[model samples]
Target: MRTLTGREAVREALTEEMKRDEKVFLLGEDIGVYGGAFGVTAGMIDEFGEKRVRDTPISEAAIAGAAVGASLVGMRPVAEMMFMDFITIASDQIMNQGAKIHYMFGGQLNAPFVLRMPAGAAEAGAQHTQSLEALLYHIPGLKVVMPSTPYDLKGLLKTAIRDDNPVMFIEHKKGYGEKGEVPEEEYTIPFGKADIKREGKDVTIIATSHMVYKALNAAEELEKKGVDAEVLDPRTLVPLDMESIVKSVSKTGKVVIVHEAHRRGGIGGDIAARISDSDAFYYLEKPIKRVTGPNTPVPFSPVLESEFIPNEEKIIEAVLKITD
Candidate 1:
């Protein structure tokens, strides 16, 4: 076993995939010599060359559109948006064209492409920071994935590249430097599966992306207070692992959902709704609680930005509110 940062894991996945499949290629702004906005693609250009690791103009729409076109022609393209906020500019190409082509063409054609988006607030202002996976989850034909750890980042990226559909691979901006243990052998985590980061009996904390780490930290604090908390990570959003969620909720009786997205219309609300609708509802001892970002734009100031993102204290409070 070896340890790697989230950025290194992503770069390794892309590098291995490109070498494994001739059709796989990458295209994005500053991804070549610049190595991407966060340097996740550093040193990739020299290893893969210009044709495989391309640097495009500063146009999100063009990048997504080009990926769609390439995928239609039997190529697997991975397009990167410098920031998840800019994904709005490419909505038409992604939501309308790439996501619908396979269904529109009677399944004869499919866009097997992966769009990598670095999301979440990291002292970046409203214009640059946003957890917009909820918007992508609304699209009918697209698959949304938000991985928290370096290990999951590598495994899921490989799976997304091989899948015969459009996948929105969302990465948290603050997680790039986070380190985790990753094996040297090749591995791929299946879609629609949940990873139980920590097991407990008193309460369950279901979280996504960066919030998963916060939830685990919260769990540790809860244990100090004699409140055992189970942490579950739904690695992928679209094909959610409802079975795992239900099982966890059924055992713990109390559950708290956490996400970096806004409290209103966030994935946390959707997960809560789904739990209420499932058989897990009868097992609930109290109402489901959510620890999420407020319904406001991300602030520019470091102090305000830190307050905007959900953290360990908020998660612990949410768990205690329901468990107590």
Candidate 2:
């Protein structure tokens, strides 16, 4: 097995899939000559040519509208929104049109297209940095997938492209540079499946996207303090792996849901509600703790941004609160 950066892993997935399926095409601003804003699609235009590796104008809505139309006509268009915030411009096409087509047609039609976006806060500031998974999760027909590791990145992406619905594949800006080992052979990780990054019994920590790495670090620190924390990563947000969460909480009796999204309307609230409604709720020794961003816009200053995102220390404190 060879280790690869998150960017490399995603690039490999798209490259390999495009080689295998002619319908798979890349379309977004700066994707052709510019090789994409993050260079994830670098050199792809040379291999696939300009038609497949398209470079559209800076219109997010047009990009999504084109993807929806392409998918409807039997093309698997992998549309890219340069930034996650830009996705809002295309919500009508995504939420109302692309999402409802399959159901409205009563399974007579399928939107087998993948929409990729660079998401999450790193240094890009408020407008560019947002964990918009909750918005896609709210939609009934959209499939939301976020990967924290290179392994999950390749696996879930393949699944999303092959599935029979519209998929929102979110990539964290910070995770793109991080490296991890990934298998060489082709494989797929099913949607709605959760991966337990670390198994323990004292407490369960549920996290998504970049927050999963923070929760893992917090788990290591908690272990040194004589607390065992189980870290569960729900790779898919819409079809969340609630069973894995319930099983972990059933054994640990204490749980903390951590996310980079705001505390008020974040996915952490939904995860907490799922657990509170589950039969495993009786096993809880304490209330489920939620560690997330404050109800404020992400700041541009490095210091303010640091405070805006949840970190290992904040997760550790939340775990301690639930345990003690």
Candidate 3:
């Protein structure tokens, strides 16, 4: 095994996939020469040449539309929107075209492609910081994948590239610099599965991306007070590892869902509802808790932004209340 940053792991996934498949190419603004906004694709252009690592103009819609067309004709394209906010500019191509083509055509053609975006907040301001996973999760035809660690990032990205469908591979802005162990050999983590980052029996803490780390920290703090919290990362929101979540809740007899996204209409609500609808509902010792951001838009000021997103304090309070 090798330890690497999230950015390095993603780069490795793209590089290996490009080497294994000639049809796999990357297209985005500043991806070729500039190495992407986060430098994740820094040296790819030099190694693969301009054709495989293209640098497009500042047109999000055009980039998505072209990728959708390319995927239809047997190309596996990975289109990157520098920031997740810019993705709204290409919603038509993504939601209507890339997401619906295969199913609408009765599986005659597959949109075997991926749309990558840097999402979540790390003091980048309102427009640059958003956990918009809820939007993609609402769409039936798209696969929404979010990785919380380096190992998951590499394996999941590889799976997304090879799958015969459109995937929204969300890279949390704050997770890229974080490092973790990843296997040197090739691997793939299947979608629709949950990873139990930490196991506990008191309460199940379901989290995503950076929130996973926060939950784990809160769990550690709770341990000192004799409260154990299990941390689960659903990984892929669309296929949503609901079974694992339900099973965990059945054992723990309690659950708390957490995310950095705005609380209203967030994925936590869907997860909570799924549990409430399941046979595991009777196992609860207390009501399922939810810790999330405020409903207001992300703020540009550091002070206001910090207050906007949920933190470990909030997670701790919610968990403590569930236990009490």
Candidate 4:
């Protein structure tokens, strides 16, 4: 087992997959010599050359369109948007063309490409910071993935590249430098599977991306006060592992959904709704709670930004509400 940062694991996955498949290539602004905005693709250009690792102009629509076209013609392309906010520019291509191609073309065509973007706030201000995992998955045909750890991202990214349809690979900005154990051997995590980061019987906490770590911290603190909290990470949301979530809630009889996205219309709401609509709703001893960011733009000021995002303290409070 080798320990690597989330960013390093992404590079490793890309390098391995590129070597494994000749059709796999990368294209985006500053990805070649500049090594991507956060250096996720550093040193890849020298290995794969410009033909496979293309450095595009500052045009997301063009990057996405090129990927869609290439995938349709039997090439696996990974298109990177400098920031998650810029993904809106390529929405039409991803939604109208890439997402609908297989259905529209009578199942004769498929778009097997990945749109990778760095999301979440790190004092980058309103325009630059956003959590768009929920927004992209709103489209009918997109497969959304938000991996919280280096190991999960490496496996998920590799799997996303091999899939026969469109995938939105979301990397949280704050988690890039975080370190975790990853196997030296190549492996891929299946979609729709839930990982129980920590197990308990008092309450179940469902968290996504960066919030998973925060929830784990909260769970540890709760344990000291005679509360046993179970932390469940729904690795991918679209093909959500409702069976695991329902089982966890069924045992704990209390549950909380957590995410960095805004509370309104956010993925947290969708998760909570699913549990409530399921037979597990009768198993809950208290109403399911959601600890989420406020419905507002990411603040530029450090103080306001910290307040805008969910924290360990907030998660603890939410858990206490249900358990106490």
Off by over 4 Å in 3: none
Candidate 1 per-residue C-alpha lDDT over 144-248 given as tens digits, one digit per residue, 9 for 90 to 100 = 999999999999999999999999999998889999999999999999999999999999999999888999998998999999999999999989999999999
lDDT of 3 by residue, 1-324 (tens): 679999999999999999999999999999998899999999999999999999999999999999999999989999999999988999999999889998899988878889999998878888999989999899879999998999999999999999988999999988999999998888899999999999998999999988998999999999999998999999999788889998999999988899999999999999999999998899988998999988989998889988887888899999999798
Q: Which ten residues in a row have the lowest lDDT in candidate 3?
A: 119-128
Error of 3 at 28 (Å): 0.5
The per-residue C-alpha lDDT of model 2 at residue 251 equals 97
Candidate 4 residues lying further than 4 Å off, grouped into runs, are none
Residue 293 lDDT in candidate 4: 88
**Looking at model 2, how many pairs of residues clash?**
0
User: In order, what is each prediction's RMSD in angstroms?
Assistant: 0.7, 0.9, 0.9, 0.8
Q: Which pairs clash in the backbone of model 2? A: none
Clashes of 3: 0
Residue-pair clashes per candidate: 0, 0, 0, 0
Worst 10 residues of 2 by lDDT: 156-165
lDDT of 4 by residue, 50-164 (tens): 9999999999999999999999998999999999999889988888989999998999999999999999988899988899788877888888899999999999999999999
* Candidate number with the higher lDDT (1 or 3): 1
Best by lDDT: 1
Q: Residue 101's C-alpha lDDT in candidate 3? A: 92
